[model samples]
Target: MKDRRARWYGGCAPGSRPVAAPVGARLLWRDPALWVCGGWQPEQVRTLALGSARIAVLGPCSATEHDLARALSAPELATVARTWAGSHTVVRLTERGRVEVLADVGAASPLYTVRAPDGAVWGSSSLALSSLTGGSVDTGWLAAYLRDKHSPASGLSAWAGVTPVPAGHLLTLGSEGGMTLASWWKPMRRTPHEASTALRHALGEGVRVRVSGVPASTDLAGMDSTTVTLLAAQCGPITGVTVHPAGVTTGGDMEYARALDVPGLIRSPFPLAARHLPFSATDVPLPATDEPAPSTAVWAMFADQLGTVASAGSVCHLTGDGGDNLFSSTPAHLVRLARSGHWARMFGDARDWARLRRQSPRPLLTAALRGNAYRIGRADFGRPKWLAAPVPKVSAPTGPDADMALVAELRTVARSAYAELQLADALGLALHNPYFDGAVLDAVVSAPAEQRYSARRYKPMLADTFADLLPDAHRTRAAKGLMVGDFHLGLRMNRRRVLGLADGRLAALGLVNPAPLRATVHAAALGAETVWPPLLSVLAAEAWLEAVERAPGTEWTRNAPTPAGAP
Candidate 1:
């Protein structure tokens, strides 16, 4: 019997209520051919059903029956979806014979689509889909993955015929057939002609909503006063974590953190030994995922903090990760002016910026001339010769300076979101970054360019946005601190493991040349200053491959379906 079954999966974390359909209890969910791996339930699944509308809110969300009803009844369901916030996916069956999905900014819940017998089936896990359809490796995706950056470039996964829905968009399949994809929220292209009064309220509420019942903690190092005050107000006297690097050259957010709290959770990693690898390295336990884990250093410092947070009875870790993007402006504003052929304005702005910085204006002019939209992601990630994959060209939208800024910010949001996801999954810790909220993005995008960066003021616009919260004194202190001692220490101690990882499945796949990869790892381990993203990516990918190949009843057959739109 050919089973044309449609099954759905969704859930939330911690307080999730477990629900499972008994085998053979529901035809749509019981088709053996259509379903596989009933054993792996990392978190209990939850489902909600309402009048002719079935909704499954998965993976830590505030998605409720009321929200679903509003979505089903409202003329603008996307708007209804927007008011709700969380790191999750809302998958629902409509009153009509239709299916729709709304995922948080850039597919946070990772709802991937796969080709099943009934037509196309959507689910939360790519591995589940691969097991169902006997899918194979996506070499084209591997080729694309070989290049630098970790932006959510597309809905494409590491397999063929599998795709994820993009962020801030709604995916709907109508009763009549075919998919209707629409954007509910577009970045505010230009600062509104009128000043937006919504930025502060939106941002404050954004911080408040991500809280769990447990006390939250965020790093004070490099944290802006706006974020600190907002978090303190919403979450109520949260502890802060600041890791001081252990070395002769020490630098971190510790200085600013001291101003925030006297006894904040200050930590210094126990120096790595030769046999010890980073907490996130291949030598450590790996999380199971359908796609390759991008290169990440979150675990480099964060793995230490997870234990402390957990011990303190904290339920979640808070971060102001997107503050810099949302609050500050770069010299790019000058370039935007030049690109628009406003020669006088560009020079004037450059001169003003130079005067404030106590430097020559010539460098600003030179940089603005060199400014471009290639989004030259991780050009720092060195290319290895083993993979002959062409880089995917991104067609960035050409528009006003404000739109460009929002686009750049969103691009950053995608990258950081992925990194945070990997870190949380690996550490088994919950996390919330208010700056990643949709409302915050809206607030930042609606502000005029003048507010983001002004020569006379230190992150003047950002400081002013939360003027009520940020102290007058703190507003003038815009200096940022950088830390790299941990990276050097972590890499130096893990060279052996790094070399061992390169010798295994990855080298056999020939996706990367082992020599350069090993050499890069070796040089970086010795603190020779080589590009790290590609090396870290290689480490994570190989570890993932090893885990996949070791699965009990599955083999990663090389010649799989080629995903459409892959490099």
Candidate 2:
């Protein structure tokens, strides 16, 4: 029986595999029967017993082999047994015919089940079961898919007829084909305050735990080193914390140097000196000086700011252009942009070549605007090129009433755009992070009138949040830092390589005017313009599609997989 079971496990013909059986039980003939077990938690097990009668059990049971043996000794033990531990679910059947099932506390793992017409029951991934049940996949779920990007909890595969066994559920199948399903666990809820306090304590403890082994003392006395140590202590233990010394090539360093040269700009605005360090700039060589150069100093002061602006601009540009191209006046713009060919248009411009050759920032701004322009050809626009709507005026709000309305509108738009951008980021499109969501923008834009007058609070909320981590002078001043524009340098340095790939792909896809895209990219690279955010999104979308094509299997059919034998 054990040998037969092993072979069954190894190579059951795709659709012919037994859905459920007791561990080590041999299938002597082709019969439609399946056993399922799921939902195990600490000190508790949820199981499904199947055979002559199907039943589900939810309670604690010792996992000892002896306990299992004794439990199986009863006459009712002719049924199959399944158990869930952690994320793994296991099934075992006793000689007497009983069945058992098991699962874990968090229930992150999933098992789906379906009963076939011939009385055969099956359980596997939702996708797999859908294939067997002849179910039609649901594309509406794709909306939910866009929201979470992960498989759903309901376990309903995109296919119809297939259903997910709820997270905390167990099911048993009987010889007569009777089936039963039951819940085995329920999550407990805590008050918001309690949850918050617990989270705070956990975060503090986590920091201490991660930094406990580091030397209690260090020779570095500078604020930057101290701030870095503190940040490391807080975030390192959680996972994936990487620390590196600031290098010259980084945008943060360059930006910092520029800021220092401007009149009245001071070093170290935040309290923690190291918070200003630029870590996101790729492979910048550290600046050398008796006292570290102010540029380097500024880098340390604004390290956290280094990666955000470029990322933010990319998202903003994509959302705006994508929204306009698809005529999506709603948040659903990302879906259309991702699906239609416009994603490619946004990134196909070659204006970066021209921008790199210019020392002035104006050309860069022009390139940025042009890259973002939704230039509909005469064929696509259904009119002559001169008939496009005049640029809408973005008039400044005139009074408190107007300001409030404007602020509310901006907040709404920003939030809507942010959610879509986050979805794209989750899907690995390298878009902006959603940190600058509506709430953050609201706070920044609505600072006290007095605070707004100061040049130190440009991004008031962000400035305040890192005030303690930066130098004192920097904390009080407001300035819009131009991070996105700096991409021109990278474009210039790697124009040939980027154009080589971007040009051919744009031509092949026929999604845009290839000549203009080529011109934009080249113009931007030569310092005559800035063509990054819009262009990058298009490139990323193309890459993503190519990646999807290369993925194994039917490539997640736009519709869900159909279940087996279903009409």
Among these predicted structures, which one has the highest TM-score?
1
* TM per prediction: 0.75, 0.31
Please give, for residues 1-567, the per-residue lDDT of candidate 1 as tens digits: 212111224211111112221132111221111122232122213345556565554444444567666666666657776655445566666566466677665344455666444345555566545654666666556655666434333445666676655557777765333566777677553453333455555555555544535466665555363365345445565666655544422333544444443232333233333233352353344445565544344444455566556557655566666666656545567767877798997888778877766778876676567664323111334455544455454323333344454555455445435445444544545555666666556656666667666666676666665565555546667567543554566767766756788777756765676776777777777778755566666676777676567653323222222222211
Query: Residues 302-357, candidate 2, lDDT per residue (tens digit)?
Result: 22332332222211111111111111111111222333445543232222212332
> What is the overall TM-score of model 1 with all chains considered together?
0.75
| lDDT (C-alpha, whole model) for all candidates | 0.53, 0.31
The alpha-carbon lDDT assigned to residue 336 of candidate 1 equals 72
**What are the clash counts of all predictions, listed in order?**
5, 102
